[model samples]
Target: MAQHEDMQEIKKRRDAVLSALVDGVPYHRFLGIGFDRRGDELTGVLNFEQKLIGNPFLPAIHGGVTAAFLEVTSIITLSWNYLWQDMEAGAIDLGALEAGTLPRLPKTIDFTVDYLRSGRPRDAYARAEVIRSGRRYASVRVEAWQDHRDKLFAQATGHFLMPPPVTEAKAGKPG
Candidate 1:
């Protein structure tokens, strides 16, 4: 079916984007922020090793680091969805474009994070849900949890502003 083929194509595109983003990210390496996609959803894992633990008394993952992870994961997942849809609709050849030409470097317009539970010194998991996607913006909700923990470590909602297309000059001389 055409729909099935389209799905496969989207997955390929998503993987390509993920590879580009994660290839040289030192912080992502520290946190294990790489993800696996299932249909429209993305699942990411984070580990709290000795490096991530800040205070011995609390044994808590730093709030700033957790927020950074949530923000990065949400933006990446939303960008992939946008790219996949654009490619499937014949609007763009995302893979053919130079990495710099990728549109929609989402800037967080606003974000609210709620700390439901303190993160333990262990692996953590996060799942992002795309609440709404529009031509110029998106809304996402992300939930993070420590391994084997009943309560969530944090929950965040973000409003992201999609960047406009890069001008031809900035895209560099045509090859």
Candidate 2:
């Protein structure tokens, strides 16, 4: 079925995007967050390790690190959603999109993070859902949880403005 092929394409794209985003971050570098794509949802896991430590007393993972994980995962999920749209519309080449080369980060018009619990110094998981996907904007909700625990450490909602296609910009460039 065509839908099966589309799912394969999406998985490939998600892997590429995840690798690109996790490359330069220090915490993500050490914590080793793993990206898994399931249809429209993305789930990332971070294992507790020395690098995530803030203080030995509480051994709490830094809040900033938690936020970063949530943000990046959410953005990538949003990007994947957009890619799916492109595929459905038959508007762009999937190969170019997979090369870390197409569409840029959409401007983040609004974001709100709510802390539900403290970041544990152990395993943590983040899952995101796309609330709305429009031509130029998307809304996503992300939740971070301590591994093997039902409590959430943090939850965030992000609104991003998808940028115009790179090809469109090139077409407008002065010759």
Candidate 3:
């Protein structure tokens, strides 16, 4: 059925995005971020390690690392969402995204991170949501958790400059 084919295509796109994200970004791999397909959304996980600890005394993960993880997760989520729009509009070649051409990708406009608790040395996970997406800009919210979603280690919200399929953003139309 057409619905099944569409779902398959979406899964393929997500896989491509995940590949390009985890493999393409060395830092992300260094952070040990893992991707999970939870029904529809992507979940990011970072297993705890000593090197990630900024305060060995507390054996806590670095605040900077947590911030970086949130930022990277948000960016990847936004990029993946944009992939569908770009492919649908035929605005850019799929290979551009697949090739890991991050040089031309969206840049952070503003980022605000809130450290809810000290990140202990353990496995860390993150969830990102695109709060809003315009043609040229997007706003995202991210949360980093160790054990459970309700117990968050950090939360971040930011805006990014989207590149492709942004023709109408500058003209003030919805993306």
Best by lDDT: 3
User: Which pairs clash in the backbone of model 3?
Assistant: none
For model 2 the TM-score comes to 0.72
Task: Please provide, for model 2 over 51-163, each residue's C-alpha lDDT reduced to its tens digit, 9 standing for 90 to 100.
Answer: 77766688788776787778877876776666555545556554665554555655678778898877877878888888987877888899888754467889999998886
Best by TM-score: 3
* TM per candidate: 0.74, 0.72, 0.79
- Candidate 2: residue 39 Cα off by (Å): 3.3
In lDDT terms, how accurate is model 2?
Answer: 0.71
Backbone clash count for every predicted candidate, in the order shown:
0, 0, 0
Could you give the candidate ranking by lDDT, starting with the highest?
3, 1, 2
Relative to the true structure, how large is the alpha-carbon lDDT of every model? 0.73, 0.71, 0.79
| Candidate 2, position 74, lDDT | 80
Looking at model 1, report the run of 10 residues with the lowest lDDT sum. 95-104
lDDT per residue as tens, model 3, 1-175: 9999988886676566567766788888888877786555788888777889999898799989999889888987787677655545456445866877642467899999999899988998888999999977999999989887799989999999887554544366543
Which regions in candidate 3 have their CA more than 4 angstroms from the true location?
1-10, 86-103, 166-175
Model 1 alpha-carbon miss at residue 154, Å: 0.6
RMSD of 3: 4.6
